[model samples]
Target chain A: MPVPAHHPVDILRFNTCGSVDDGKSTLIGRLLYDSKNLMEDQIEALERSADITGGGQINLANLTDGLRAEREQGITIDVAYRYFATPKRKFIVADTPGHVQYTRNMVTGASISNLSVVLVDARQGVIEQSRRHTCIASLLRIPHLAIAVNKMDLVDWSEERFIEIRDQFEEFLPRLDMKDVKFIPLSALTGDNVVEPSSKTPWFTGPTLLGHLESVHIGSDWNLNGFRLPVQWVNRPNNPTDPRLHDFRGFSGQIAGGIVKAGQKVMVLPSGLISRVKEIWTYDGPVPEAFCPQSITLLLEDDIDVSRGDMIIGPDNLPGQSTELHAKVCWMHQRPLQRGRKYFLKHTTQTVQAVVTEIEDRINVSTFEPEPDAPELALNDIGEIRLKTAKPLIFDGYAINRLTGSFILIEQGTHATVAAGMLFPPTEAVKPEYTDFSI
Target chain B: MNSYHLDHLQYLETDAIHVMREVAAEFERPAILFSGGKDSICLLRLAEKAFRPSDIPMPLLNIETGHEFPELIGFRDRRAKELGAKLIVRTVEDVLARGLATAAPGEVSRNRLQIPALLGAIEEFRFDCCVGGARRDEEKARAKERFFSFRDSFGQWDPKNQRPEIWNLYNARLNAGENMRVFPLSNWTEVDVWEYVRKEKLEVPGIYFSHERECFRRGGQWLPIPPPHAGAGQPDPYAGARPKPAEKHAKLVVRVRTIADMISTGMIESRADSVDDIIAEIAAARVTERGTRADDKSSEAAMEDRKKAGYF
Candidate 1:
């Protein structure tokens, strides 16, 4: 079939995780290869490389397992991104390493992913790394989970083998809070039930990987229930040459949530005064309405006051504004996250001085349980912690809105990203103390 | 065309536009690093989309190494005029005349010298932000870069000290004299850029497409013959000396790849001559675009090392 001009397939951002030699790379490679997304040069290079296995054909795994060390050792060491497009959707595949040492890299890749593809070798069933990845995925609140029982051909493509793995995953699913979970049994190497249905697995009936990706309900993936647009910059051309731009004021940002339309009442956070959306501006042109995650310029009916680092939101359903916050953080730095350690808390467009107030507990990945009274969080550790910001921040629970509810902890001295955090339920509900404070 | 998904292209487009706006709003003086490559072409298109009906809001800066393809230079000039934006050309030859950059004895490539030329231009313009089309997926060191990457006063990028970018919140704040290298297409892949160009119907240099050229094998890859003014002491500069008599001659055939400088960039043997052919070729190929870059073949971290010294 010839390539189409306008295939408006849905978007799918997914991460892959599995134990070493569990065929994670093979799964992604098969998806891209079988889908005919691998470029001609890429295929030729793969074929020419000495790393080609016994079949004398190109190693699909080499497409994603990029690092020289990883290639030499036959493992993934860092997060590699792969892109492919089908008629139904466009996919950004985050091929994360599965080694126990590279867990931090996996967390980084999985943080932004909407779906987590957990590959389980049919023989191994469920391993520690598989559980660890699923826990991390659940902790990150990925809405969808697909347990790909790979190497089915190795296990004789037996339906019993697939069921055995599925049953094991089911026992652990109730322990975590995943909204939608699916199980697919297929051999990524042989291209069974990936983009196409497998006649071999007639005993087990389910949608193909491609079918699931295309038909999945992703419109509800974004948090459209709450209105949040953190102002990245205040657009005031103030150029007299273009009189139209003279006194043309607009706050530009990607909407974090909710529907924003012309004439909708909105409030600028930190300064509680209310205003109306005069227009929603985009690169193409002005639109009557805009929604979450769409980068846009909003012209206010009344230019009462606004600037970068401020957030514009619906006055009725405003985010929780407080200086203290309790959140689940995935510590990413080698340096431990200790109480009283000062870091920059970057939430939306605002960065403010912040300190770790307390470490409630660190969740053990292997067992998917929390260990109480952990003093500090080391690298690749997930924990619930309380933080005190130098200034107030307006945010919602991460479950409700991924954009507004997420933040990063920047090391004060080096400015490195130390942790990825998801705001939990506020520990204290306190009213905003109105005061004129400037940085 | 029927299987094209707009969401992926649209997402990449939106992300690039957002980064452009951030550079405009955050920096005092900004410029787009126009290399006349596919990536930079995509960046120029994104900039047009970002602030159209009002110029690009910044100048298009090209640090000419004097080793660029002639076709590329012509395309760059014409495209700049088409967009009605200022095109600022800085040359290493000028830096050489001023003694700011000096080539080593018997050196053929001025790529190493480009660092000084680029830094000199940044200082001359007092630009706080320089928008580029670098993608993180291109290299390992780039994988650690933020959308709004910070550079020291000397224009050095310390990958280990990059700011954490979370949930699209970019921290563009920097001290005076320090500049930021903004990569709006940091998230885009090579295929994504081509698909975008096809989708947007963007015009790029003809050299990008498959074309017949006088080329020979050198350092395990193909290199184009230097232009007449390229100072020839080097016979078969396209092909390094080999044992076979037939290998001494240059091969005139269509080439697929055109990554960086014509002198250093290797060409892949190909029959695909159009965008559709190139796309089909790419869809079936396993080799990366960087596979043909002779400079990168020098070492594993050649791109990273250059990047640290402020070679954008």
Candidate 2:
């Protein structure tokens, strides 16, 4: 077959998570191998490793276990990113470890993923680890989910066994806010339903796993409602020789939400100053309009006192601005997170001093229950906390816009990043009663 | 479908540009580690796009191993001149002469010698951040690396103790004597690089295309044959002076998949002469780009060990 010609296609980012014995690594290896993404040299290297393979069988798990310790221990240590492409779409797969101790790593992987693939062993259906991964995926507000009922061959490829496992997931999936879910029965080791339709499952008429991945509707992934631009830098080319750029000044940043057009009215936060966009400058010169995720330089009509760490928004759907923030945090440090601990909160383009004022509760991953008033959050712990920052943070709920709602905390003395957080909806919108309030 | 949509290439370009601008804004002193390779060629274009109609805020830094191809060196100088950016050239020979780094006896390749030269340049210039062209798709250990990789005072990497990078919001804080090695191309692949090259109409070194050269077969690899001698009493720049006894010499038409030191860089037999052909060839080729580099083939963890010791 001839290689597909290069054509424009959208990208899809997803992650795979499961228990240690559910064959997550093998499933990923099978996907890449069957897709013809693995090069011959890589395959040769895998086959040449005698110490890791036995009985003349190539252990597919060796492909994603990148670290020496991980290989020696026969487990994945951290998240490893793998890339492959079909003619329909390009895929970036974040292969995460399944160890319960590495829940923080899974969270890190899921934070940027659009879809989450939760692997399940058909022999042991719907275990605690499977539920925990699915719950976390739902909590991260991932738009899509796939429950791969792996090792179906171990159960003789029985339709009854597949339906039984799907029923187990259905009991708890409705409680979660997941909208799109797919279930597939396949054997990762035998290469059954991952890429090709298996003859064993004559009753299974749905698309194969690869077909589902390729045809998933991901066009409405990004938030395109409220315009938000956090000023990253002040582009000032104080050129004396060039006549066109003698006094050029613009605000440079990537659009976090919504669309921005030239001559549109915008409001700068904290100052309540409104201005019209004079020109939108991109890499290919001035453009008439741009949308979410496009990096551009905007020239405002007025010489407003806007600088880095400030936000520019459109005239409608104003984001909430408050000093007290309620957020869900995934603690990643050895030091237990407690009240009265100060950290530097980095949100959007600004970093401000923030202190943990209240520890509300912790979410038990195994049972998916809330433990109220947890004393402290330990490593790889997910909990809700209230914080008070030195300055007001303009943001939306994470469910609305993941870009403007996420943050990370840096410890005061050690300067280590200790937590990843998603903000709740602000209680008030910086005094909405006043039409033109300035702080 | 709505009209507001960005293709994969556009998305990658936007992300890369944002990273470059972030480095410019956050770091006190920064530089671009330019190697004049295909990846670095993309880096320079992104830098231009990030801060254009004005001079680039950071200077270009190159650690010449003294065994580099002359064609690449010429192209590097000419490109920097065209952009009007300052190019800082530091040589491994200078590092050896200053007693800053020592090479093993009869060591012909300077692959290991580049570490000290790079660290020395970072210290001498007080560069807080250095933008690199490393991509995660290059190696296994690199696949686990962060976009803003932190380095200690001695420039060592502890893969197990890395910071938790959540999203595009990167943590760039550092203490004294500490710095960062930022990769804007962490998510791109080899095919993406070639396709972007074709789309942008950028010029690369001629060594990338197929050419006729005197070569030999050694250790199952096709290597270019070194010249007879140094004219006008200049020292020999190539690593190998003579072929081994078992080496079979021949004249072959080949192209380099990756550009490293001339001695360690291997050539593959190909008839591709254009960017489109190269992309198509890569799509159907069996061997990986890094499979041709002799330095990475020393062991399974060679790239990991070198990266841990602060080698770019």
Candidate 3:
């Protein structure tokens, strides 16, 4: 009867990135403040905090920099996530630190974000940190990018100043593969054009930051071209009271791509066995259809031992399954990522023993160029590398789907996530499943 | 196709389910840290959705401070039985009895002792991952936590050195002595929880809704002092403060915002009779749900310190 209900409004996951002094936190604080999302106690805590600035004004950055060290040091060292919703959309903002040295944390925040907001101070137009953050957003393949040229109030809301920053971003925007990029000029300190359009800036006309955030076109962000469901668990309740729960064996996973219907032809990866969906089940009840991002338990018509780590996909467009993978990785550890280092590679629900076969090259974040002859990737280094796994991984190119394309490296000894990787298009792009002429 | 969209609450439910499944697939021994709160109640429904035809892969664990509400304990047992899941409980009193945890001389709340009781349970049961219901929006320290948060061999969390969790690929690898605290509700907010509860028609304790109760004001919060509070030495927070009874008429209709211990839960004087009313109140309330929490009131770094010592 519940029908695995669907909401009218879409949910958007985005992140805010800027240099240390670029007012990234202030911008976020203003968004929360203007949206009435901040709680009174949180504001009271802010007012009571001793970390107020010289000018005082209830230091809005205190809303995010909640850690004691960050508050004392006046710099955000890690990624902090904030949530707020309007009538139009629900938003999850991963406010990542923009100290170029902490780029690894930026990558972590960007991996799951659908959009990225890169703030730039109007005084220092398009600095190296801005370029680095924009490059990182592009590298992570976040679908949307919003460039907020902040401190417009300080510059007297000059249209020339706003256009100068916009042109600077436009110069570098072509080199990257950003599809949807929007530029908004505003002052985070004065709350000029963050939530509501400011009357002061009559020369420049653009949606306010919050307005753009609420109306962004993110429906196409998910991969609808192909179907992918990486099985995370096997749901077998086997309840004695109810016959349905008693023997209902459902393969559970979040649909990573496309739509799945009750009778669609699907194939389980690694096994290569085809099956038809018997029923799509949710906690509320069975649904006729399910799609990408919906975690559902499936009752296959002919179950041939499907479990966690296996993938259920639309047989028409199957993902590649290879023991060896060429991937672009962002090294996140102190010890340099070099060839022949064995680590635990976690891709989706699967974890396998993987050894770095080769370190190809590193990408320079500032210029967006690849550097050859890199012996090893140091901490926070973005590099392309090859890996050989103990088992085959079912995945797509990161450009296709972030859920299936992304993975993280866990150092075998310390068990720390050492790298975030995106699958590089292999030389042999046509996968084994596609080689079959017989449909 | 129905345009392939889930409501925000449903999306959160799906995300939490995926986290649970990942933990189930990866961890050697995993458990859900149940506190009988709304978050954990949502988690029970998720755990059921995750592994319904079979038994839940892990047991439900609770680190009791020995001062929890009787209603919570009863609801916990009943719900655990309803789901046919194992409920493993370890009390701070037991830890104190065994001399593993010592209380500060005048400490009334055993909130700090909960860390040891929890870590001791992990060590005793060899649980590699304990799924908690902590949301990022709850507190500042919690905002920086990963869905699969790592705890080192010392049973401590180093907030500075957290692993870079990218996307849905959670690194659940751990050493023999180490364990991971998985938060399935990391992305869920308070409003989403209430919406999901109302949609699923899930059962929570009666305390969540409006109820008449005898309460007292301590540090500007209405705390429901249970019957055993009359002769407590250092176990009652009001021992030194001498918590005053709100003028007899002050025994107004109130509801528990968060289900902490009877000593720590800050009651909101409300007439929220239903889930919709609760949602409306939460939307309009100026104070955060955790702001009413007595345990996190000490200082700005209380949650961080408690987390470092491995408190859920």
Best by DockQ: 2
**lDDT per residue as tens, model 3, A316-364:** 5657788899899888889989899999888888888999999989988
For all predicted structures, in order, the TM-scores are 0.85, 0.97, 0.94
* Over 4 Å off, model 2: A1-5, A50-55, A430-439, B231-241
Task: For residues B192-302, write the lDDT of model 2, one tens digit per residue.
Answer: 998889888999999999999888887678888866667667766564635787789888889999999678889898888888779888989888899998888988888
Tens-digit per-residue lDDT, A1-439, candidate 2? 3445667898999999999989988888999999999998889878876445555678788788788888788888888889999888899889988998787788878888889999999999999889888988887888999999999999999999999999999998988889999999999999999999999999999888888899999889899988899898888875547887877888988899999989998888867688889999876889999998999889999989998889998866679998999999989888999999899999998899999999999988766677998999999788999999999899989888888999999998778989999999877664444465332
Each model's RMSD to truth, in Å? 5.1, 2.1, 3.2
**Model 1 lDDT tens row, B207-244:** 77667777766677777766554446744332332224
Which pairs of residues clash in candidate 3, taking residues 3 or more apart in a chain or in different chains? A7-B7, A40-B286, A236-B52, A236-B53, A236-B54, A237-B52, A237-B53, A237-B54, A238-B53
Interface RMSD of each: 4.8, 1.8, 4.7
Report the Cα lDDT for residue B254, model 1. 58
Reported per model, the fraction of native interface contacts reproduced equals 0.29, 0.62, 0.83
Each predicted complex: what DockQ?
Answer: 0.30, 0.66, 0.60
As a whole number from 0 to 100, the lDDT of residue A318 in candidate 1 is 53
Better model by DockQ: candidate 1 vs candidate 2: 2
